[model samples]
Target: MTSSPAVTAPAERVRPLELFFDLVFVFTITQVAGVLTAAPTVDGLGRTVALLAIIWWMYGGYAWLTNALDLARPGPRLLLLTGMAAYFVMSLAVPRFFDEGPFGLILGLAYLAVVLVHTAGFIGTSGHRGISRLGPLNIVSALIVVAAGIVPPQARTWVLLGAVALEALSPVIAGIGGFAIGAGHFVERHGLALIILLGESIIAVGTVASELGDVLRVVVGSVLALVVSAGVWWVYFEREERDSERLLDAMPPQRRGRAALLSFGYAYLAMITGVTMAAVGMKKAVTYFTTPLHDFELWLLPLGLALYLAGLAAFHRALAPVWEWTRLVAAVAVLLCVPAGLLAGGWLMLLVAGLVLAGVVVVSRTPGLNET
Candidate 1:
C-alpha cells in the first residue's frame, strides 16, 4: 500500500479546519484581555503576560502542526479538532487563572490535553520525526502548568514563570534541526492570527461604545481607536508581510524553520500582547473619555503601540538585512509621547498614537525612505 503524504504541499492553501481552530484560538485571546480588563495594574499586566506567553506558545505549535501535517487525512483532522476543543477549555479558565480557585486546575488540565494532543498528532503523521525532539519538552512545560495550579496563588506566578522559561528553552534545547515549514500555509496562519488580534481591538471599541451614554464621545473614541488599529494594520500588511513571505519562500528549507520560529512564533507574541494591551486601553478611553485617565490607562495606550511597532521591527529583522529602523524610530517616538499623553488624558493619547502610527504608514509608502 502507498503511504499518505506527510507534509503539506507547498501550493496548498490553509484548510477550513485551520480557520476553525483559529476561532477557538481567538477566544483565548479574548479571555486574556478579560483578565487585564478586570485588573488593570502592574500585577495584572504581569499575569496577562505570563498567561499569554504560555497560551501563545502552544497556539504556535498547532500552527506548525498544520503546516507539517496534511489535514485532509481523517486522523490528522480529528486530532486538530481535539486540539481545538482543548484550547476552548483553556479559554474558559483564562480569566480566573491567577485567582485562587478551581480555575487554575482547569487551565492546567486543559493545557495538558492540548500538549498531549499536539505531540500525538505530530508523531502520528509520517515524516514528522522531528517532533520527537520537541514533544517531550512540551509535555514537561505542560506538567509545570499543572503544578502551577497546585501552588498557592502567590506562588503560581513563579511556577508559571518556570513553564515560560521551559518553553523559551525548548527551541534552544530541542533545536530546530529537522522541522519543515510549508511557507505559504505558515505565513498565512500567522497573518490570520494577527487579523484576529486586530479584530479584538475593533471589538473593544464597539464594546466601549455600547456601554456608554454619550453618543458623540463614543463615536469620536471609536473612530480614533479604529485609526490607530488601521495604521498598525497598514504597517504590517502593506509591504512587510508580503516581503517576509517572499523571503521565507526563497530561503533554504533548513533555514525556513528557524526563520519561522523567530518571526512568527516569537515576534508575533509581542504583537499579540501589544494589541491586547492597547485594546484594553482603548476600551478604557472610550468608556471614560470625559474624565482624567488613571496612570495605567494613560500609559497602556502609547506603550502598547510602542511594543507593537517594536514587534514589527523584530519581524523584519528576522527575515531581512535591515532592522526596519522606520518602525523602531516610530516605536521610540511613541514611547516619548507618554509624558505628553500623561498631560492630555486618554482620548488625546489615543489620537497621538494614531497620528504617530499614521506617519509611519505614510513614510513606509515613500520610495527612497522606505528601504529600512
Candidate 2:
C-alpha cells in the first residue's frame, strides 16, 4: 500500500511583523476614507470603490502569500519588507490616483511590484501547479494597471476596473488545485482585517462627530454608530468565527484553498463594501444632522447593513455549505426599514440600522433562525 503525503497547518499565532505589515493596510483604508471625504459625489464614489478593490486584492495577496511560505527566512522576510515599502508609496499616491497625473503611473507600478513579488516570487520557489498558472494570469492582470497610466483618464478607470475584475475572478478560474491552506492563520488574518475595517468605521463616525455644533447630535450619533459597529462585532464574532474556523480546519487540504478563495476573498469583499459605504453614510449623517437625508443618504445605511448581513450569510454558507435564508430575510428587513428611517435625522437612521443589526444577532440565537 502506498502512503499519501501529510498535510501541515502553519503556526496558529500571527507574527508581530505581520501585524506591523498590516499597519500600511490600515493607512490605505484611512486614505480611502479620506478620498471619500475629499469628494463625496457619485463619480468620487466610483473612484473610491475602484481604488479600494485594487488595494484589497493586493492586500489579500499578501495574506495568501505569507500563509504559503515560511516568512521567518531571510529571503521571504526581506521580500515582505520590500513589499511594505511599495505599499507605503502606494498609499502616498492614492490621493492623486484619479487626477490623471504622475500618481497614476506611480500607483500602477507600485501595485505591479506587489503582484510580482507575491506571485513570481512564490512560483519560482514552490513549483506549485496552481500558482504556476496563477502567476502568469496575475502578471497579465497587473500589467493592465500599468496600462492605466498610459491611457486617458476614462480609459484609465476602465483599465483598472478590468484589472480588479480579472484578479477577483482569477482564483475561481484557476481552481487552485493541490494548493494548501493554513486554516488558523488564514482565519485569523481575515478576522483581524474585519476588525480593522470596523475600527475604521468608528473612526469615520468620530471624525464627523467632532465638527458638529450640537452636543446632543454628537453624543447621540457617536453612541449610535458604536452600537452599529458593536452589532457588526457581535454578529461575526459571537459564534460564526469559531464555527467557521472549525469548518475551514476540517476541509480537505485540496479543497480548503477554494473555500478560502471564495469565503475570504470574494464574500469578504461584500462585507468590506458594506462597512465602507456605512462609514460614508455616517460621515454624511453627522454633517447633515438637522437636514433631511438625500435619497442616496437615506438608502446608504440600509443598503450597507443589507450587504453586511448578506455577505456574512454568504461567508457562513461557504463555511458550512448551507444557505441561511433567515439571515437573508434580515437583510431584506434592513432595506424595508429604510423609508421610515429616512423620516428622521441621521442619528435616528443610524439607530434604526443598529436595531436591525442587533435583531440579527438576537434572532440568530434561536433555533432555525439561521436556517433557510
Cα lDDT tens digits for candidate 1, 84-198 = 9989999999878787889989999999999999988766453267778988999999999999988888888889989999998899998877666777788888888888888
lDDT of 2 by residue, 1-372 (tens): 965433234546577778878888878877876777677666666777778788888787788777766666787688888888888888888888778679889988988888887775464343256677787778888889888867777666678889888988787677677555678887888888788878878977887788665797678878888888899889889888888889999988767877887788878878887778777777777676656676565666777778888998999888786887766887898775465555666766777778888888888788876676
Report every candidate's CA lDDT.
Answer: 0.83, 0.77
Clashing pairs in 2: none
Instruction: Give, for candidate 2, the lowest lDDT window spanning 10 residues.
Output: 2-11
Show model 2 residue runs off by greater than 4 Å.
Answer: 1-9, 123-127
Q: Please report the candidate that would top TM-score against the real structure.
A: 1
User: What RMSD, rounded to one decimal, does every model reach?
Assistant: 1.9, 3.4
| Shift of residue 106 alpha carbon in model 1, Å | 0.8
Q: lDDT: which candidate is best? A: 1
Report the error of model 2 at residue 311, Å. 1.1
